[model samples]
Target chain A: MENEFSIEVRDLTKMFGGFTAVDHISFEVRHGEIFGFLGANGAGKTTAIRMLCGLSLPTSGKAEVAGYDVFRKPEMVKRNIGYMSQKFSLYQDLTVSENIYFYGGIYGLKRKVIFQKTEELLEKLDLKHARNTLIRDIPLGWKQKLAFSVAILHDPQIVFLDEPTGGVDPITRRQFWDLIYEAAKAGVTIFVTTHYMDEAEYCNRISIMVDGRIEALGPPAELKTRFQSQDMDEVFVKLARG
Target chain B: MRTIYFILFKEFRQIFRNKAMLPIIFVMPVIQLIILAYAADFEVKNLKLFWIDKDQSQLSRQLLSKFEGSPYFRLTQADMSREAAETAMERDEVDVVLEVPAGFERDFLAEKKTQIQLTANAIDGVKGGFASAYGQAVIRDFYGDFLEENAARLSWQPPSGGTINIASANWYNPEMDYKTYMVPGVLALLVTMIGAFLSSMNIVREKELGTIEQLNVTPLKKTHFIAGKLIPFWAIAIFELAFGLVIAKILYDIPMLGNLFLLFGLSAVYLLVVLGLGLFISTVTETQQQAMFISWFILVIFIFLSGLFTAIENMPPWAQQLTYINPIRYFIEILRSLLLKGSGWAELQQQFYILLGYAVLINGLAIWRYRKRS
Candidate 1:
């Protein structure tokens, strides 16, 4: 049963002082599933993702990531999961290859393995020329793609991406999703949080969080039908207003 | 271990790549050392003086000439009026005012003593004290010579047939070079200031750059991350200290009487205390700016309480008590005692032990706090 699901949550709650940031929410993500966590700003999407990534402890309830309990086995969970934060997290002072090597090294990859992976990743991203270039000098779209690559470079069971494509253009967002689809095809489960309804449509399944509670959860087509809407955008608007 | 190594490699790359970091680590400390050693001077010299001599007798003339011969005093005006000299002092023209009144020889012959006024401007108390002492010595010398030469003419008998002579010697610093006294203290400061500043700002810079969040979500051990961050800065600071010591030896000729191994050993432990304080500050602060602000505040206290500028014994009792907790004070004391006094480990074991305790306590708290937070 644990092998079938990548993430298991039952009544996961997080609070800061007197304010409840994440209410008791329960969900499960299957192996290789593209699960979109959609919500407006301050709707607790980021907080929920933080708990799944083992970056924050839940105030109450049981949660497990990549078959490891987040509370009891957070270190193990961290070992099995990869994360890309909303804010760009690569060392801007380091070169692209240096960034790749650094993340791979921390993830416990062998130096030879890191070297091999570096050549393969640079070729695949068509960034071989920019390998020696500083991250600050790189283009924004390329930087985002590079960040996502570094996050999953460890070959974690699940990859958590929090608003991985916030400020990119529509074409770049599509290009970013192409990378996500390629990873999903290779049997990597992606747990991503974003407010973009269009990106919600690309997910196999998504949960709409409203004020710390998951108001709707289903396939995008099913959600659109259930809300009597044309697309995820209309469904989100109707659900948010109610 | 490999994780720590990787992190260290990455940290070194970033540190070396940073444009401002190299100068901050290497060039700036040496610059500060040379500047501070030369400029933090305590010796005062060439005190300016004004004189008002009313008596035309050879006694008064000879008294005025005595001041003229001394190297310490610069007699700017010889025939200035009392009112004019007082005005000169008021206007910051002279550091001292020498006044010899009329009938000075008659009064001296009758009473064996006469008053000669030496007034010093007390704006700079140290300079004023030196000025007054130098002036009085000259006047006393003139009086002694006059009494000896004119003994038959005046028929005056000396109160004491014999006078006591005192001889003084400066032991460790034979030349009494203030540079020798200041070099070790400033070097200690150079090591502590730059090391603490860099370490304290390290983690917070990651926080500002959003890298800590990324690292937090990974399998990298907390202890490994801390060690990686600290080891590079620690090594760099030790290397910088060695460089400064070499410069001190060549440039200032500061003595290194104690064992080099012991000095380096103590310095290593002392750096841990400093770096740990920085790490603790980094963990608590939210931004690099806040961390830098707190580091500045702590550094100001460290420099002042370390007795780098003023002797700790001379501080108020309360401030003296504060030095008990200041790590920099113990460090500066250890450095000076080793380099200047040739103190052995047994003589300096107390300082070594206190620094060890501090290293353990501060690093423990910083590690515990960081682990608890994550």
Candidate 2:
């Protein structure tokens, strides 16, 4: 049987010593979909993302990422996914072009291809002038855009973005979403977690995790109608509080 | 291999871009080399001496003059009473006192035995002992002279030379220049410092910045990652050794008597041992501060027992046994033999094998501990 989903989980759980960080939860995301994983802080979203990305082992569960079993085929899962955390993902001291080259090279891209992709990326982002500037010297908005581009530079089947737009202005946040849409159109699956509820509505499907369990799941319009709320923000509040 | 090249390129860029790191890696070791070589000297000189000559005889004056003539002792005051000399010693103003009794010359003429009383301040016991030994040597020479004059006056003829002749010569550093003895050991220490600290700190810095989390998710192999990290600092350590050797040659006239390739070959193996140990420490630790503290703890223990400043032979049997496991000790021994004694590979084969075994063991363990995912 051919499984068409980019990610599939069933009764997935993660425990830290005696504490269960992620309780038994399951979900499926199709290829080329922007899946918004929303939760309060410490709601086990990051832990779930780690499990899917093959960075952490699930305590007792089954997860398939990019058509590979996360437990038995983690390296395969890793090779097919890209990861970018808000706290990291780029060498601060390296120039923009060097960072691109380094990450691309690590993904085993040829030097000629890396050069071509770098030129295309800098031009598309309108960052040609800052190509030689250190990432530390660039603006935070530009860094996020570059980080997202680098995460998808290998053209992996799935790209996991953990709060990739935190602390940016509303304009840059929307611009970052534009980049995400562009990537999804290119058939790259996006597993994004965010604190911004407005960003949650932009996802094709959304899951709200509360106390290590997914409290709500569906499209934004349906979730709003079901909760009798105006938007994802109110719907999220009702799920988290009630 | 290509993955490793990418990581290596990034590490080199980061290392060179940080303005403070390059200076710390290059300049600080050289400065420490010059200063510590001069400070770690063991040769004693310029001892202070005072005298009370109650005899006031020609013999007493002559003996005192002998002490004054030697470069090791400086005569400060003369003709003081024994009590005054004691006072100066208590005040830490004098190092030694020579008291000649009143009957010194008279007893000698009457063919009776005579003695001279020598007192020394024992606060710095080693220096005091050296000063007293020098004083005794001068007196023995004077006694020989006195007997010679007497023999001439009496026309006395001996059967043969009375004493058995003893000839002592120091080999391998005939002048015993302490700098010559210390430079190679210091160079070994410099190599160890750079290799251990830089590698450990580099890994932990990545951890602290949360960059490791990004790396952990990548498809990068653990062995490739470890090799990539080790190679950059390994190259830097070799560079540092070459730089320190040039400084050692120019500043101290240290002769590089053995084969350069042999020394460098062993050094490369020794660097792997140190860098591997450092990488192992980093894997067990989480923060740069924790890594630094652990590295410092082990490095301090290794350096003190390395026979760099002191002789390993003088240590207790168990401590000497402990040095066998110390890579720094083997490197220091290899360096000293090569630079000072011109020892060849056959003489240093044992150290080479031990270091090679340690390098393999440590690096294997380090690579095992480094997991791409937990």
Candidate 3:
């Protein structure tokens, strides 16, 4: 908490009715670090991310995002963080520039700022030619990339990507990581969730979630060595099964 | 504020892009206004009639000629027997049946009193009643004329020369054209439907597409987000209303006697209520299909109870009590009164206040129910 970590979760818990979805999970995402959260189906990765993003209330424990308390100052937390979900969360009927302007506007960016950001983002993504094209007509891989770009259009302190690369081709996945690297280079913390074990190797630090709790938290290399495995996949299998 | 604008812009883009919704929003109302206006006339026309003139005398023949000459009734058959007249009435071919008793002329000459029997279909009671009244009036006129002519022949005169005492005048729509009354009400119905139907699907669509989580993570306040989503549909609903009114005026010859600005202003306020209800529904429902189904169900009840097709006063007491809560009832009433009766603010202040309350209450409920956590 004393350090300049962008996100800090201390024994965070979230429950729906009588069922616990994210149970007493504690972790930290350092500034500018790419943290990978890996989990199987219903592994509570989404629930935990939701709590950290100020999108859901934790049943107990506490967390802070960009130095703002999750419960008492969730609005501040929301303002400093960006989020992209697996489903390509954007208005499909809207054009690329329209989506950027809309999301940027919601984040309280000035019109001139939104205009400037829209021009810069489209050029950076090489989407200038299709800026006016409806998102529904764009290729799926481009849509995902554009969605990622839109999420961080306001230059938030942290960007949360919930399985952002799901259903994308390997080449596009690689390109998507390049964008994440670029954002990380700019001192923006990247908190991402994925089922793709291979992606965990690219993170600065990685956590494995199983049955609503964090099973392992460390750099990819350290986690693999500690579990006596050759790769992160084997390490996850050992920890998730245990 | 900017976020809400973005939401609104996106919503408009989506509405324009969806081919099916555009027609449902804009075209359907105009078509309904045209078709229903033509079909929903309370003034019965082309009425088929059968008369039993038992005497077949010159005087009876003259009375039958009066029925033939009247525009209200098309004398389809002159049956000699009472049984044939009754059969024609029951078979639905004839809406009205007249029985001129055997000694009608004789009794009129002797005692100055005669009776005629008129039977009409009572299924559509209002239409049947109007037809019956028309038939009775025509017969009364014929009898009065007969008495005048008879008095001249006998060289004897009664007081007032057998002149009838009744004078009738129809209010609002003197010509009794259904289109003039129905078009305005339908405009209200259409505007409300667009607001409730389209807005109900707005947030649920994001939820179904799994983008609600993205919106949840935005820095936008809940109220701002909801406002952004609702305002565009509200504007579109108003636009649709305007278009419907234009069509009503141009195509159907609907009068615009009241201030157009007042109509639009009231429509804008009413649109907020409907759009707010739609957003509230979207927040509660999980799927677009559920939103649509629930909206349809609510709309059916609203339209039936809206006093668009029937007078609210004619409904049962308990049902009439429910009309006080229905926003459509007031809107339709205001629109019709203003458009047809040229009613001013003073005449419609009660309805205006009720609609204003509905607009505020519904939007507040929508904002309250839209939780940041869920």
Highest-scoring model, DockQ: 2
By lDDT, the candidates rank as: 2, 1, 3
lDDT of 3 by residue, A79-193 (tens): 8998998877888878888888888887888989989988888888898999889888999989988888888888899999999998978999999999999999998999999
Model 3 gets an lDDT of 0.85
Predicted complexes: DockQ each:
0.71, 0.81, 0.72
Relative to the unseen true structure, what is the C-alpha lDDT of residue B6 in candidate 3, on a scale of 0 to 100?
Answer: 74
Question: Which candidate, 1 or 3, would have the higher DockQ against the true structure?
Answer: 3
Model 3: per-residue Cα lDDT over B1-374, one tens digit each: 65667777777777778889877876797788878787766667767888788766777788888878888888888877878877777778788888888888787666666788888877778869978988888888886777677776655666783465866686888876788988888888888878898888878988898878788887678887888888888878788888888888888787778988888887888888889889889888999999999999988888889999878989999989988888999999889999999888888888888888888898888888887774
lDDT of 1 by residue, B70-169 (tens): 8778888766478898888889989889888888877876765678889999898878888887787887788778778877776657766464545468
Correct interface contacts retained, every candidate: 0.77, 0.77, 0.87
What ranking emerges by TM-score with the best candidate at the front? 2, 1, 3
Could you give the C-alpha RMSD of every candidate to the true structure, in order shown?
A: 2.1, 1.7, 2.4
Q: Rate the local accuracy (lDDT) of all candidates.
A: 0.89, 0.91, 0.85
TM-score of chain A of 1: 0.98
TM-score of chain B of 3: 0.93
Docking class of 3: medium
lDDT of 2 by residue, B22-109 (tens): 8977797779789889998878777788888888888778888888898888888776588889989899988889898998888877
How much lDDT does candidate 1 score?
0.89
lDDT for residue B207 in candidate 2, whole number 0-100: 88
Better of 1 and 2 by DockQ: 2
lDDT of 2 at A156: 98
